[model samples]
Target: MKVIAVANQKGGCGKTTTAINLAACLGKKEQRVLLLDLDPQGHCSLGFGVFNEDARDLYDVFTGEAVLEDIILPDVFTGVDVVPATKTLQAAENLPVRRDERDRLLAKYLMPIRDRYDYVVIDCPPSMGLLCFNALAAADLVLIPIEMSLFGMHGIDRMYDVVRELRERHGRDIPVRVLPTLVDSRTRLCRQFLREIGERFADDVLPVMVQFTVRLKEAARQGLPVIAFDPTSTVAVQYGRLANETMSMLQDDAATDGVGEPATGLPEATAAVQHNNPANEAVPVLQSHATPGGMEESRKRLGTMKRVFEEARSRLSRQGGLQKVVLRFYDFTGRDVKLAGSFNDWRPDQGVVTRTANGIVEKIVMLMPGTYQYRLVVDGLWQEDPSNPEQVSNYSGGYNSVLQVEEEHATEHA
Candidate 1:
């Protein structure tokens, strides 16, 4: 089975949302997906409508008190299974030295029944703690979710550093990729930052983007993924695309290895990543290194970085937020065009539907810098936006169009 960890050192970057939805989307494709929620907050269980926590969970699994087989539950969705977490998992942080063993524990537990599922997706906590390390240790691929924010950008460097540290210690270079979330195209700053990220991460960034959408929050409230809640929503479709991209990447890796799988042990997979990178840091430096300027200097640098991030947040906040956005749909000859989304609480009838020149349909509204999922109702028939390529499965036999209202001068469309 391929292990993919959805992780980021930054909180609220859509990590849990991505983890749950991606697994659900993969399940929709008939791929057996097991989502291990290493997050102490236990959002996965909540997503699945399981309010009652199991007395035994990942805490037991990690502490060797319970077996994974016994703890694994499939109540989340049809083809997706989940190993939920609880507050007790926080105890993992206090795990002692020789931590690489703890890191490797996930891999060890997963090895026995690894082939049962096609993929094991782990939702890691938003910290560089032991739990995150364990997830990284077992992962074949690390997917980092980054919101379009100042703090989000700063965490990327720290996340990279953690990956490199793993590479140096384990002699296996873990491949990490960034997935931009909550991307608002309406903001000039958001758009420009995205461009900068594309230039910097380049091949390391996933092609699919998740727009800021309240449907994600709604789905959680309904105890379902957006794909299940609104199968035709744009965010759901984007998750589907993300799953396909990940599968394709793995397929290519297997072919490259010529061994029918990404070379057996962790070292081989890491080495493959190491060999594949041309633009990233080279191999020699990937080796173990001494602490640069000792612990005190590292602490001082971290303080400086914190201050820098604060300044960045202040600067970016000014450049982002609510703006006048125009939602337009073109080339529609339908009777009336209505819009429904979270902005209007998904009320189809109350939306202002107007017909513009050249058969162009449009709705002008002020929106903040975030992702939103909306669909056009053309003559009483709900449809995905023709002009907007960003969409997700609404699970209602249709699709909801995605719109990113960036924090720019305005006039952005979905």
Candidate 2:
């Protein structure tokens, strides 16, 4: 099953809306989908016409008082199930366990039903607390809903730091993709921000942006996903495009391994691509190393490097929350290295890996609390870091290493 969490630290970013609509679209396409409302507001449940004053909700699951089968309720729309939310979610902060343990609560609950649905979409609250951490820990991928405002970028660095910490410490490899939502094409600032994000994120950015539209509100007011409420609307069309793109990515990811199943409900050609295509070979690895100044260096890098910046937790009395995971590349000869990847637009200079005092090349990056897969760029070549033992070969035959950050309550909560 593919579990996706729609999250954003900044409020009013359309995170809940995306979760509701995206689940609806997937269901409309005949795919089995489950929408888990992690937000205390329970907007997702209300959007699907399943609100009840005394319903058993996600809170039951978190505390182990209920199982998924008991809380799941059919929505007005067919093929979609919802696990509603209640005010109890707000109490997560007060749980007796350590903070990191709270993040694993959702994962423990979902473990039982992981394979029941084709897609599990989680709608997260607007803070980096136990609730959001639980959603992140339970998710296979994270969809960050970014608004077109200047402050939109404010907490993103912190989010990245959390993701990195989760991966390096926990060994979870969750991939995160950013989605541009509530975009106002008319505003120059919005347009500029979109362009900058596109240039900065490149392929990591989704092809379709959710434009600011009245229809979105209309659909919400009508208590239906945008696709069902108005399949012909612009927002609906954009959502469809996003769904298709997401399916394509999953299929591509599966092809490298003999594992991933083809996406149902797509055209024959699309399905073919989604399935294994021997013709599509993995790209060659790049060369990377670190320099003396702690910067990462990549040799023969051809694209722009996308850097995901995040905030470092404060260290009032004890050691700081966690240090950033540094990515450095070294040549076979142990010389300084360069870096390249989907984030860096494959450009060598984007993330220059610097050498260390002990002759090690490295670059430090702050990632959010999740798992991340990356490779190194050596002298004009791309390859896995021999210094690190955790590596996996993608379907493309390229090597990738997994890094995990421990959620505040991962162990205690689990």
Over 4 Å off, model 1: 97-100, 255-414
Once fitted onto the true fold, the runs of candidate 2 whose alpha carbons sit more than 4 angstroms away are: 98-101, 254-414
Taking all chains together, the TM-score of candidate 2 against the true structure is: 0.62
Best by TM-score: 1
- Candidate closest to the true structure, highest lDDT: 1
Tell me the whole-model lDDT of each prediction, alpha carbons only: 0.70, 0.62
The digit string of per-residue lDDT tens for model 1 on 301-338 reads: 55654565445555654755446667766667546877
| Cα lDDT, model 2, residue 295 | 21
Error of 2 at 53 (Å): 3.4
> Across residues 266-326, which tens digit of lDDT does each residue of candidate 2 receive?
2221112222213232211111122222122222111122221211122211333333556
